[model samples]
Each structure stands twice: as structure tokens, then as C-alpha cells.
Target: MKPALESSPGNPLAHLPFYYLDNFHRVLDWIGDRYADLLDGEEQAFLAGFPALPQPSRALFVRMVMRKGQLFRASKLQYDEIGCPRAAAAPLADAGWVVADPAVTLDELFDLLQKPEICRAFALPAGLKAARKDAQLEALRAAHDGARPFSGWFDGDAAYRIVAKPLCDRLRLIFFGNYHQDWTEFVLSDLGVYRFEKVEFADAARGFRTRRDIDEYLQLHACRERFGNGEHPADVLHDVPPPGTDNEWLKSRRDKLLFQLGQQFEKLRDWAGAHAVYRECGYPGARARAIRVLEKDERYGPAWELLQHALREPESEAERQHLLRMAPRLARHLGHPRTAAGRLAPPRRLDLALPQPDGDWWVEGVVRDHLCRDDAPVFYVENALINSLFGLLCWDAVFAAIPGAFFHPFHHGPADLHSADFHRRRADRFAACLAQLDDGSYVDTIRHNLVAKYGISSPFVYWNALDEDLLELALHCIPPAHLKHAFLRILQDVKANRAGFPDLIQFWPAERRYAMIEVKGPGDRLQDNQLRWIDYCARHDMPVTVCYLQWTQQ
Candidate 1:
């Protein structure tokens, strides 16, 4: 079997394995059909001329473009897994794409792919001689121009040509792993196809339904000479196909796409077109976009009216909070007298007593020490053990239930469902995930994460945070319903509520009774989110105690 090149960072060309190479080559072919009009006369000539060449020759040129290197070994073509191999080197040589050198051999190719220190250990056995160099390879390395040692197309001194759209398209796909912003911007900007600032569109709303819809539509349309010149997505979006479903998730996608389209036009200083797109797609966030457009146009009255509407019913509490904070500034902009700021209603404090005077670290220790003699055994768990560690433990189950929950913007966690209503959309799946915590499967999931996923490096195993004793205590004492409720509560706002769980948990192993204790040192107060969680626990009849630490004078 070939060496695994999946995560080989040292050799950037490692991704040119048979599997990825196949799709990349195909996308390249599509690029010709997709963007032929964007090509200059010379590039069009290349496209017309490419298919006339032998398949082997095409393969070799494609490999050269894929490798993005001047020098390559002929033996690399011998790999049976690839489309073209050693038997097909003649076409590439005749075409002058490679200056295949005899010095570069299969041994050298393998050595290049392997680390320097380990190459010797994996070196080819003796008695195998490298095949003779083909004419293309020899001619390339031998070409000389302008008094240089070697100067061919591959030479650094050779006149640079604008890369054909298909080749550039292929390269972009290979590098970014998707044809999104990188490919779109590169093919349009680098190809000199669309000078965005000068480009104008007649029917900006005819062809696009979503961002990807606009991108693919433009990519396909912009290369045809008739449609290629100064095409506007805002013009053709109306002609886009109706969506298969009118669900909220799909609606949100259209909303986001419309917002993005507006932003792009605004960036181009096409305020009218931008405003039209925003109004056409008046989703939840679109009003905010409309306000900005009005403000940009110096229509303060309309902007203020739109701003008030946006503030009245934001998509989320967070958005409402943001709008509330932005209100005074918008009022000032419109020359309104400053309104007195209202104070927040203070949080009702929960009065719970700790056994002794303690500091931050001592609070948990003191709680544990007090609970040691109780009928229930107590454990002081760090924040991570309760939330992050537990989160990882149950990740697989939750992922199975609500796959979209894993979709994080940072690419930090996991999942990639592109819907604004992700949490709401996956409510059933989240409930399924909660079911896992409610059952006895929590032990299996935790063990799987620790032993199978992290092995020795698991924080639960390595950091002495989660032990067999605590696990046993939890299994014996913590009710599955309570655990399920806790998990469900956190899932409501995973990012915000995963932490702030009680520091100490006391459990009666025999009676299957457990209680959570949030330890607070002097001057410490419960955060709003934490208070919300506390209120949830109280309503749900889950045992929770707020242990305030009154420090003793030394």
C-alpha cells in the first residue's frame, strides 16, 4: 500500500495522491467548460489545444501543474495508482512540460516524500537502476536563454504567462479543498475577468438563490462572453429556482445569503442595488442591513425608523441587548436629547451557608472536608471535569443525535450544518442526546472518550481529576434524570452554560442521592447565565446549593 499522506505537512505535494488527484483533475475539466469566456485569446487557444494532445500528455501537464514544481522525478509517473505512469512519460517530454532529469530517480522521489532522517531507513533496495530520461525532461533542464545556465518555461528567468483559468481553477481547488471565496476571488480577480469596481449588472437578481448559488451561477455565467462582461448577481437572483423547502432553516440560509449579497454591493458602492437586495430578502437580520444602507445613504429618518423596528424584535436576546446599547448612539446621531439610562433589576440572591470560612481554593476543600463525615461522600471536581471533559465524553452520542451541534464557526468543535436555526432544528436530536445521559450509557461514553479517543492523554485519566472512586460514587448516587436535566440545561446554551457548574458534588452512594454545590469566595457573585442555570435547577427540583465563602482573619 502507498504511504499515508493524509496529514503529511512536510511535503505539501503529498495531497497529490491518487484519490484527491482524480477529483481535482475533473474539476479542472469543468473549469474549462465553466469559465471559457473569462479566458483571454491565448488561454482559449490553450483550452482548444489541450484536448488535441494525447491523454498521457494531458495527464503529465496536469501533474506538473499539481506539483507546482520545476523539477520532478520520472519515477513518480510510474505509480500504478495514478492515471498515467512510467509507460506514458513520452507525451509529456514531447510536449516540453517537464525537463525530466536522469539524476532524479524513484529513490530520490521516495526520499523527497520522506523525512531526511528517516529516508535512509526507507531507502529502495540496491540493484534497481533508474530508467533513462525522456526527451521532454532532458530538453527542459538543457534549455538556455539570455546567458543563463538554464532558462526554459520552468526556469526562474523565463517570461511568466498568466495561468489558464482551468489550471488556476484546479490549483485553487487543490489548495483550499473547496471552491468558495478563495477560488471565486482568484478566478475573477486574478484572471482579469471582472474588475469589481467597474463591473455593472443589468438584472442583478435573476440567477442566484443562495451564496453558493450566486457563486456557481456567476462562475458559470461570467466566463461566457455575452454574460461574462459586468454581470451582477443582484440582477439575476429573481431567476433562481424556488427552494425545495420553505422551512425556517432554509429561510435563514436565504437570509444570510441576501445579507452577504448586500454587503458585497455596498462594498462596491452600489448602494441602490444593495438596498434593493436587502429589501427583497427582508429576513430577521435584513432590517439591520437596511438600516445601515439607509444610514450610508444619509437618510437618517428612515434609518432611525428601521433601527427602532430592529430593536423591537431582534432575532435573539443578545441581538436585542446589542441594539439597546446602540440606541443612545443612534439617538445622538439624530440630535435627540440624551435619555437617562435605566438600571438593570438586581438579581435575587440565593442565601446558602458554607460550613466554614474559606478562600477560593479552600472553599471546595472545606466543603469536601465537611461532607467527608456526612452520610454522603463528597468530591471536588475542577470546572473542566464537569463540562469540557464530560462534553468530550458524550460528544459522539450528541453528534449522532444532533449533528449540527458540532458546527462551530471557529472549526473548533465538530459538525457543519449551515442553518441559523441549528439549535431549534436539532431539538429532537438534542433530546436524543439527553436520552443518552439519562441512560447508563454515560459510563460507556466517558470510557470511550478517555480510553479510545484520548488514551493516556485524557485529562480525566492524566490529570487525576476523574477517578474510579468518583465514577463509582456518581454511578451509585447521581440520578440519571438529574444528569439528563443538567445536560439538557447546558445544551440550551452550550457555549455560555457549559461552565459555572458547582465545584463540589456530594453523594450518598447507598441512597442514590446527590447534591450540587457552587462555591463562591469573598466578593464573588453569580453571573447572569449562572443565575439562569440556578433558576432552572430550582424549577426542575434538582439539588443545588450556593456556598458563600466567608474568609477568616489569619
Candidate 2:
């Protein structure tokens, strides 16, 4: 099959018969050259030994590693391009990169065999022969539960165990800046599925600063994986690496994992354990979770204390909203005089009753259609328009070539976009971008970026949702002050505040005025983040309204 290409002549993969092998080699070369210092003894040995392996062995090993599982049946691995699968794998087995007979659990055995194969090998009773694969597994499990090599069970052809998977996974992590992406990134780029913004940097500008960082990242990843696989929260917490690392990026990951463990503890209704996990976690929403957990257990005084601490400096607007909701009742519990912050008058309300709309139309769409007019048109922007505008204006700042941010070519955005010090690291750059709004330079800057940086991946840009008319309308309609306010608020909590904008924005081009409307269907209530945005709009005197919808015919 011909791989799709953005520009065929420019791609080296165009002529390559073994494109995946080439991509894998490129990653190995990049890591060996750029991250030589980070490579430990085993990794270095693997890199040194890889070059001496036969070409077929290298290609076969990479194919197995890129696939879903660690085990590959030799018979099933037939490749027209690679000649004989068994012949190709023999050198890899000899090189100690793959195990010819690795242990497999009963479940793994079941997964490896078809029903007929299982029936032939195990001789299932006729009554159980027609059952589901899992039921067959259960029936056979009592006699054949323990892990054993494939040869011990089936007496079938060989299965290759990728013994080098963990080592290669770490190398992949270093090359891609995380474990999420794999070798297909190069192919995707080659196939024109994505076009990344290339940022220039020396080899010294890699993501990991010290060897400890790499080890800690792998350790934490293992812990996360173990927890995800139904390990107890307390047990997972015990395995999680302690959080004193100087690498803020790794530290952020550690904190998020702890926060997630705390949440799992909450779900398990182990309140004390949840509180314990949350106490050490400095992640964005940890303190709020701790407060809520305390409240759930009716430990009112401690909950009140923690709530006060969170209220003093809430990490996010979402956390602040949660704290405010807890305060009055908690204050009453403590016999303290209830002090209620004055609530602003709510946004103007629109009540509408409309017919059930045509195929698969949502409530927001229904309201948008009903309210839109020839002169004043409404777009169901939700969070897209403002975020797209912000992303365009701050394109340079967001994609800045800071060390540890853009180590790899395929980054959708900075690796540390959610880290606590993300803004502080790029303070000057973001300041410059936001300052353009003040001097009226933003219009031209945003317009320029919209064209220049078009189609590149961004955390904030919704490319499909934006068009020229929408951009021009927003540039003219949204006041510079309003845009600045929204940008600054986003800077406050990029992770949380990007959402919760009013649902629809109506533009009145002739009048040069606009209003943001948040639509709510029957029985629906405003979410906390939405309420926070509404409160913000009220304080800033930005026109916003809440439209409540009811079905005229149900």
C-alpha cells in the first residue's frame, strides 16, 4: 500500500521497503547520539550490540516491540518482506534480545489459542465445548492455572518473548519525552497524518537533566501501571517514589499519581487513607479532595481547618469554588458567625420552550438555532472560540524552545504545560504576548499566527471549530480588555480555566456588540466552573446570559 504523504519527494520513507525498521533505527541513533549520558550500562550494551545484529533480526525484533504484546507466535509472524519469521527470529533469540520460551499465565495461554486449539489441547467436555472463551478458561483454570512456558502447555511452534521490551520502552520514553507515543510517530509524520512544528535545540537541551530523573520516571510509571491494574491504593502508595526530586516535571507526575490514588481511596470509602494520600499530594485538586474526604467522614473540625488552608490560597478556581461551597455549613458546625460573601446578581435569564429538534441534535444546538437571527448570529462555541483565539495569540510563547519543553519533534505542546511553574518558566514570553492586547498590536499578531502556525497541534487550538469569518468577527467584537481578562484568567489555571466559557456567543456586527449565552436544558443546573465564569463575567461587566430550555413537546 502507498503511504499517504504531505510531500512525497521530501520523504525518505517513499523508497524504503522497510520503513518501520528505518524509523526504529532513527530513534536508536538519536538516543545514542543525544542521550548517551542518560544511558545506563544495560542500555549502552543494547545499543552497542544492536548494530552487530543481522538485518533480519533487527527488523523482526523491532516489529515485535512495536506490536501490542510482548509475545508473538512465530507461525503468525510471517512477513512477505522479511522472508522466514523463524529464521529472522533465531538471531534475535541467540542475541538474548528475545526469549524462545518465556513463561505465560493460564490467561495468556487462552489468549494465544483459538477455541479449536484449546479444545484439541485440553479435551474439554462436550457440555463445556460450546461455552464462551472466558468460560472455557474458567473450566480449565483449576487444573492449569499457574504460569508456564508455551512448550510446557501446547507443544506448538515457538513464541518469541521480547526480553528487551522494558529497556526499549525507556529508550522510547527518552526519545519521545514520555511513554505515550511510540515508533508510529515517525510513520505518521511520513504518512502526512500530522505535521509538527519543528523547534531547534542542541543535544544538551534534553528532557531529563540527571540519570535519577529517568529512573524515577520509570519507577513512577510502574507504580501507576500497578495501581491501574487493581492494586490497592495503600499498596500502590507504598511503591510510589517519594516526591523530593528537583525535577519539577517528574515531581508533577508523582503528585498527580498520588492525587489519583487518593481518589481511588475515596471511591473505596477508606476516608483516612484518602486523607493521608491527599495530605502529601501538592497536585492541583488534592487539598480540596482532602477537605471533602474529611467532611465525608464527619470529621468537621479538621475539614474546616483544611478548608481554611485551601481558601487562603486555592490552587485553582475549581478548588476555590469547592471551598466556598463547604464554608458556610462548616462555619455553622464550628459555632462561628456565618459570613456570606455578597453574591452578584445572576446573569439575565432566557426561558424558551422549543419542539424536539431533528436527528441527534443536542440541547445547546436547539437553543443556538432558536436564538440565532440574520443580524445577530450565535455560534455554539462552548470553550472553543476563546481558547482558539488565545492559542493563536500566544503561539510563540506556548511553543517556545525552552529546555525540557520541546526536546522531541512530535510534541503537541510543552511537556510541562500542567506543571506548577509552567507560567513562571515562560513568564516573559507570555507577558509579551498578552501585552500586545494592551497596545492594540494583538489583532495583527493573532492574524499573523492564524496563518503562519495553522494546522500545527496545540493544547488549546480547536482547528476544525475555527474559520476566517469566526476569527474576524471575534477580533472585532471582543473588547481588548475582555480578551486580556480571559487570557489572564487562563494563565491562572491553564488546566482548569480553559473550560467553562458560556456556551454560545452571538455577534452583532452592525452594532459592534456581542453577548455570551450559556444554555441549560430542562432540570440541568450550572456546573461550578460555569458558575465561576459567570461570576467573573459579572465582576468584569462582560455581557453574559443564561438560557434555560424546556421541551414544548416531550
Candidate 3:
């Protein structure tokens, strides 16, 4: 019999006792409507058979699938509704949805049993009785290289292995378009912990359009897991197939896995292996990373050749910074004339030597307190204020319901936010949003969104860091030209430029002026990204300052 949603009286969305089962059913129904073409024989069979099981049985299976692992102890699973765990599991086991007698290795066995139970099961000596659980397992592990059933280990013991976990995980992937989010998203939404923007999705929209995309996603996930499990990079790379040409999202996943594999090789000092991985990798920073590896390998000639090509058409300011730093050294090593990549002049500076505050105060907070006056106040707004302003201003373009941009309802932002074609795809929408800046309509647009879309999940907006007073102060003090300049730079490279803003911003209400400050403690040095941002602000003649602080002797 089909299970029903058991919500508390008078509250359809709250107090759902069987919310997981309801969520699972929603996924099945969604797949039946939207992704029926992508389901294979196994998935088709599982969906067809799932509803015919008893309600308690379906609930029990979902409990196992949503849980951490496949193996569940029948004695421990005591749901109030499922009176007896063993009885509920019987239907699942009989239907072959769960393994009745699965092999349990020493590692698995160690995790499942207490020390006393393990000792009693394995008949360890009396002296080993006082040892720790790990000690006892290690003592008996050598004798048992083989796996045995739970009943074989401890008489009258019962455990179950959900054989449908792989299929369930695939269903999750299909619903969410990624494995990072699980059924907990439903719970969080129901509880009002998160509120996503409503975007219209066409009936044709599916996370995976073809069956091959689904298979490739699974393969990429496996390769990532293998690499993370400390498997050899070369072995993982051998299994990682080439990225899908059609799906930028899947290609992004593949690129990240390949980039990580390359970094692993670099960590092992496998220069040749690292170069091989980076040469074919199209992930951001791959080219600069490959050049660094070539330099490490002392291949100055090839490094210089590739470095020249990169400098001609630098991917982002980050890559340009790396290539510029490399140019002088590489040119010097080649015994050629010095090459000069234009560098920006340093911005204005502010120096302070204040007694360090007590009670675990951070550097930014200390500086903020020191700088605030009655007429002017400083906020420790590290990239939040500016990014939040931009997020509010461009909400339409960011959440535009383009194909593949948003495949699911729970997305914090677009799936292809970092894809190469992200800007190209939404050029018109973003252009319309940014056009308001020139015509003096941006203030109204941003103010409207701040009130309308507040507390909604966003990739850039930090709701906690912004209040109406602070945003109003920024809008009044900061000029539209400055906002336009900052937003333009962000649009150039959203992934890289979104961060690395000044640590603190001081606003003057009466004077209608503001200055961004990058604070540095005694030993803290500026990172490359920070230097790039400071230089960008200087280049645009924006009011910015780098503050150097030294602890005073009390």
C-alpha cells in the first residue's frame, strides 16, 4: 500500500513524522513526469516495485537510504511507528531490497560491535578483555582476513544491508543535479531555515537530458571519491573519462576532479605526471599551475613559450599576475632582455600603532572599533557589503531561469556560475540590470530588492552582514560611478573577483564619503588576490587605503 504523509494536525508543512517518505515519493513522481526518458531498467523496476510494499516497509527502507551507510542493526532501529524493526525489515529483505546475510569485513565488524561483544564473539583471551575497543579489534583482525555474516559472528544477531543505496543515490543526483545536497534540503526548506527564489522552469527542463549525462556524472563522482580515498592519482586519472561536451555543469565537475588529480601529482613531486594532467585540463588556474610545474622541472624554454601565449590572452587577472611574475624570471633565465609587465602604483596608506585589545578580539574588529566616530562609523565588512549590493542589484540576471542554469528548486545560485559561458548566456539580462546604474535608477532597484528578497539564499549576499541602515548609508555615501566600476570588474570574473575586497569600510554620513581599508597585523602579509584587488582600486582612482598596524607596548 502507498504511504501517506503524516503531518501534525492543522499544519501541512510542519511536524511531518514521515517527511522522508513523502520527499522520496515526490522525487519518484518528479522523475516519472520529467525524467522518465532517462530511467534505465533497474531504476524503472525499483520505482514500480517501491509502492507495492507495505507503508512501514517503505518508511523503513527510506530511513536506511537517507542514513549514513548501508548496514543497519535491526535491534537498534526502534521507530515508534514501526513497532518492530525486524518485521518491517522482513518485507524489504524478502523483496531483495536489502541483503539478509551480507559479508562483514573486519573493518565493518569493528565498527558494528562493542569490545565485549567482539571479545565474546571471537573468544579473545582474558588478558585482552581490559584492552580498548581498537586494541581488541587489532588483536583479532589478523586472524580474520575473511568476512562473515552477522549471525555467524554473534548468535541471534541481526543486521541488514540496503542493496538499493546506489539506486537511491542516483535518484538523489537526478533530483538535486548534484550529490552534495541530500534529502535534508527538503527538511530545511520545510522548517523555513532556507527560502529559495521562485524561478519558472519549463516542462522540458531536466537535470540530465540524456542517459549518458547521468552515467558520466556517476563516473566523475566515483573518480573524485577514489582520489579522495588516497588512491594513486595515476590510477584515478586512468578511470576519469574526458569531460562531456554538451553539459558545462558536468564538465565543470570533471575539470575540478582532474585539477585535484593534477595537484596530487604535484604534491608527490611527480612533475611529468602533473604536467600531463594540467596540459589537458581546462579548469581555471590549470595553465598557470602547469607553467609552475614546468618551471619546477627546469623546462624554461617550453615554460617561456607557453607563458608568452598566456600573457597574450590572459584568462583572468589572477593568471595575468602569475604570468607577469614568471615573465621577468623566465626572461632572465633565458639570458634575454628583461620583459616588463606593467604594474599599478600602490594605493594610499594609513598607519596605526594601537595597544592590542584583549579578550580574543580579531584584527579587523579591533581596527573597526578604533576608527568609528560619532559622525562616521566603520564596519568589518570584508567583501560582504559590496558583494551583497551587487547580488541585490543583479538578482534577476543571477537567478534567470536559463536551461541548465537552474535545473532544480533548491539551488542557492545558478549551476553554471563558474562556467565559461556564464556571462555570455546572460549578457542581455545582466546588461539590463547594470544599465540602471547610468540612468540613476539603480538606487531604487537595489532598495526594492533589499526589502523584497531579503533572507533568500544567494551565492553573494551575506544577509547577516547587511542591515537597512548600513545599506542606506552605503547608497548615500558611495557614488553610483564607484558602484558601476566595482560591479563591472566583478562581471569580468565573478568567480575570482567576488572575494579579496578590503577588510573594513569606513563611511561618513555628513561628508557623504567613504574609504575602504585593508588591515594588516604585525606578521600578516598581503596575499596575491588581495594585491590584485588593491591594485584594481588604485587603477580606477577609487578611495582605498592599506592600514599597517603594530602592537603597542602596554
Error of 3 at 88 (Å): 1.2
The number of the candidate with the highest TM-score is: 3
User: What TM-score, to 2 decimals, does candidate 3 have?
Assistant: 0.94
Q: Candidate 2, clashing residue pairs? A: none
What C-alpha lDDT does candidate 3 achieve relative to the native structure?
Answer: 0.87
Q: List the lowest-lDDT window of 10 residues for candidate 3.
A: 1-10
Candidate 3 lDDT by residue in tens digits, 431-527: 9998998998999999999999989999989999999999999999999888988988888888989999999999999999999999999988888
Candidate 3 deviant stretches above 4 angstroms: 1-14, 119-125, 139-145
For model 2, the local distance difference test gives 0.86
Clashes of 3: 0
RMSD of each: 14.9, 3.3, 3.3
Question: Candidate 2, which segments miss by more than 4 Å at Cα?
Answer: 1-15, 101-109, 118-156, 202-204, 297-299, 341-345
Let me know the TM-score candidate 1 reaches against the reference structure.
0.42
TM-score of each: 0.42, 0.91, 0.94
Q: In model 1, what lDDT does residue 218 have?
A: 37
